[model samples]
Target: MNAASQSLSHSSLAYRPDVDGLRAVAIISVVLYHAFPFLLPGGFVGVDVFFVISGFLISSIIFKELEVGRFSFADFYRRRIRRIFPALILVLCVCYAIGWFTLMATDFKMLGKHLAGGMGFAQNIVLYREAGYFDTASELKPLLHLWSLGVEEQFYILFPVIAWGVWRWRGALLPVVLGLGVISFVAGVQKLPSNASAAFYVPQYRFWEILAGSLVAYWSVFHPVAVTRLRQCTALREALALLGFVLMGIALFVIHEARSFPGYWALLPVAGASLLIAAGAESRLNRVLLASRLMVWVGLISYPLYLWHWVVITYIRIIGADALTIVSGTVAIVLSVLLAFLTYRFVELPFRRARSSLPKTAILVSLGAMVAAVGMLSFIKSGLPFRPGLADKVKARETYAQYFENSLPEWAYFSRAGIFDAYRMECDFFDLESYRAGHKSEEPRARIDAGCYVPDTATKVMIWGDSHAQQFYYGLRQVLPDSVSILQVASSGCAANFPGRAQDGKAYCDRSNQFALEVIDKEQPAVLVIAQAYGHDSINSFVELARTARRAGVKRVIVVGPVPHYEPFLYQIVIRKHWNDTPRRIKDNLIQTFSELDERLERKYSDGAGGFEYLSAMRHFCNGEGCLIYLGDDRRTGLVTYDYGHLTPPASLDFAEQALGPRVMANLELQ
Candidate 1:
């Protein structure tokens, strides 16, 4: 055997039951967080723990071979394939199969995109582009958890090459690795406040956690006696291990998604995991707790468990089931555990242990071809839209024709330009220069136009606020005469109030709203219309906006009240409750329940002290029976809103005619 092979021989490395136990802890924390976030709010820190463990173990093996000149990149890659591919591919295939039946065309298309990203080990980048970690939309994505795996895979790709180069140069591994970790940690912290999604998903910001483990591995290999001496100091080792446990416990119990993460806060879990690994199995805490048989067994199946849990939970959420309830969550947990065990036993073990008829290179090539084929098929076929029996109930409905006519392909509909198209502001708002510039700014400036509705005429009316304000534009155009010129200065998620963080925690909304107010002053349109989603805090801000508009020589200030909002997205509600049925009136009680916030806002605005006119959207949409989410018997008249709160173009037109047409015409002297 070569010296490198001798150093990496199985006898040279002892099995660490404590590491397996640590794996158990990490997997359990993640599973619980997915199933019941409230139960262990900081359980997501487990991914950080996993990152450290992976860095430690993988680096230890690589460093061993490097020290003795036995490291083969090809061999290392083959081992990675054997370890990661079996369970991951199996899970991906299963998720795709389930998604085929449960998801809508748009959702299925996203599934295809995510599947491709997962197969390519680029899910983190894909998800970063899609939405933030805590976005409601993210809950519906089955492959969202694969982002962490993507980060790890990316790390491994670069780590081995860099480490080998350092070893080849005969440089000290410890200081170089430690310096890299510190740099990564600092970069992550610096970026966390500005580009949180990048900080969370990008490998550079996350490498430190993994490198912390690599540092431990370096010490283990280079200073075995020192490690032994430290482990032998029973009192010191136990104290350190206990302290580490406390830090991790605090992370599991106290950390939450609301806080900026994987930055400075990540140190708690990463350090705790490193301390436990450094203490070794000899420590009382490691021996009694982490190295127990139960933990070891859990650790053994942790990979499959992690793979199975999120998809199940996400599917539950997709189907509109109560994913958080104890009963349903328990069922999901049980199902995940069962599926995990089967996958581990049948898929993982067999593929890992069985000798292949083909060479490792050929086997890897075949696997890569299979993965590529699956991804391509999913993407090109648009997740097999013609899948038999899928959406049969939806297709059977009379509204299906209209739904099909309006529904663009998922990818086309969600493109940056496409989403803005829903508001009919794509041409004006998404100019290439503006779009690129917006990304660089903390508060993206809104693109205001004098002639959205009538380019020939001067600006007669100004519309302001967030997306809610933008939804009224189509309606305003439809109801107003040709002579009326309207200018819309609205930003998504920005409310017309004093500058403050928006609900999405973006400062752009406030900055844009303030800028829009300045434009209204400069333009001095005949009428100023203000609309926003209802929030108690925004009431004062709306009042301020109205006063500012009136002071700016605006003839009128019309404050459009909040519309009824649904729990899940309106489209999801339609798909679940009404997709198979003929057009039916929405129930009054249901409308009342959904519009509870609107009603509260209405009451608050009833006082109307600011000399601003308050108009309730419920007045036009709701009747004695309920609200009109869809109009006409065939449900072809209008879709009230495409999503939970944003109006479709046709619905906006209808709303303009019914709610604001007469009021706006009177104010403009056009009727």
Candidate 2:
């Protein structure tokens, strides 16, 4: 036992402006990363920075109180309420109020669920399961950033009690906390390969980062003499602080969304934060750079700044891509900073300073309860579906359904295969899961049409890929003659890959893709058409998959180019932005984001690689004016796509007849 160290209690500690300065660094990184990921691809690590900071500060307070024999769970939680609730309640209410008008039933429902997650400090768990394909839901959910808070609060719920128990047995707290942190780190590494999203979000996989700071707090508090001696060395202090910055700099520049994060990559930010904190106020760089007036001011508001920026940018994106200009983004950031300052000054300060006849804790708890009530109401009421101006929108949706039912005959491939019901929501956002629990409930029982194989008078045309491929079944039926048999096979989350490992529960994708290849060899279908979600996987991977199909003795392999994708869904876009009584044409700014990629694919593979063809599905759906937004004669009749990128039945038929049919039939007259 370090008996001498126990004498130095919480009374020895003083506020460090450099800590706030470090906070400024973390919050700025996160805000910029969310708004402009490219500029700071690894900026998400800022949250880890916050995690370490929270652990150190929270642990120090608990240890200090425990040493003084004044530690109370009630007091600890009340302090937390004062620290966290004011800004959180305000943000939740604002998002709820705005969403009442802007969000549809489903989106509003998601918002409610997310809001509940936020209020309960379980946002991480909620978001972990709520992920969509490519993890693209981040930009959509306003309170997604609250996931960090969830991890922090969850830690506090467990940590203080554990610390109190361990503190009674002298010197046991450090070993116990350190042992738990090591276990968490090992678990995170194990989970990363099998499921990166799980590693990123789950509390068990994430606690090590917080514990790293907790360890630092323990070291600083209990070994005050040793720490002071170490930091007193001017050269050593500067070098350690600079090394911390270097590690964080590497994380900010080198790591990106493509990287499996919160794995080994997370260590950089955690270590960096630990080093900066351990370096303490005496380090010259920490004093000069981190503790500067501006840095401290920003750090003071970092909490609210973090809360405001995402909601601001997310609402901007929800409005439509046109409004999400660089100028708009800059404005959003500026506005967030302004709001953050006001919140810090008025909302947060009052709560922190106020003493009430009723305890401040009670007021904060009540506010949180009210916010939870709002979220619950939104969820239970299905986003208040009776909001005005939705009659025509509902009618248009109904009309689209009727159009699909009436256009049924050309769906022979799906009818004979009977694969429609199972793979119906592939490439869809609402139905997507990170590692969908229901998918692994059973192995995929794919129903392939016998005509897809068994060579006869019919020349078989097989469509292979994900849901995007299944969508073609509708179009091919309309354009191609009766003699030309179309075979469609697809799986959600498979997205046309060289068969390999997928997220947990998605092992079926590899088997299905391999089955597709085996079918190619066995059936020797005249055409192997690969259609997948747009702007996913690499061009090399797609080209390699096509090459592999050609080697399988498929006479021709047509690699379909990226489709025109829409953000926030085409229907929502129309309902929110273009839902006027008059007919309106929709241009796809989202597709144009991928226009360069589509163009590059066509240019590289257009000339044909061993009877291989590259068909631009995008071109058929777009023109000089813009991408197709409506499938029928007018916008009122039917929109082009139901969700973000999945084609409506009419658009599928239109795209097939106009683009794919002519391309496929050009070289072969098998009939």
Task: For each candidate in the order shown, give its overall lDDT on alpha carbons.
Answer: 0.72, 0.73
Best by lDDT: 2
Error of 2 at 358 (Å): 0.8
lDDT of each residue in 1-671, candidate 1, tens digit only: 00111112243467888888988899899999988898999999998889888888888998888888899898888777767777777788888888777776656766887788887888888777654211345766788898988888888899999899889665567778999999999999988866677789988999999999899999998789999999899898998899889989999987898767977889999999999999888899899999999998888788888888999888887786223578878988999989988987897777666886867556655775676577667666655555677555654432332243222223233352234555655313323233332222344535444454334466478787767887888778778877777777676555666655544445666566666667677778788888876553344466666777888888888888777665455556666666656344565214344366667657777756666777888767776766666765545435565555666667777788877878888777731
Q: Compared to the true structure, candidate 1 yields what TM-score?
A: 0.84
Cα lDDT tens digits for candidate 2, 194-225: 56667888899999998998999998878899
**Model 2: which ten-residue window has the lowest total lDDT?**
1-10
Best by TM-score: 2
- List TM-scores for all candidates, in order: 0.84, 0.87
Candidate RMSDs in Å, in order, are: 5.2, 5.8
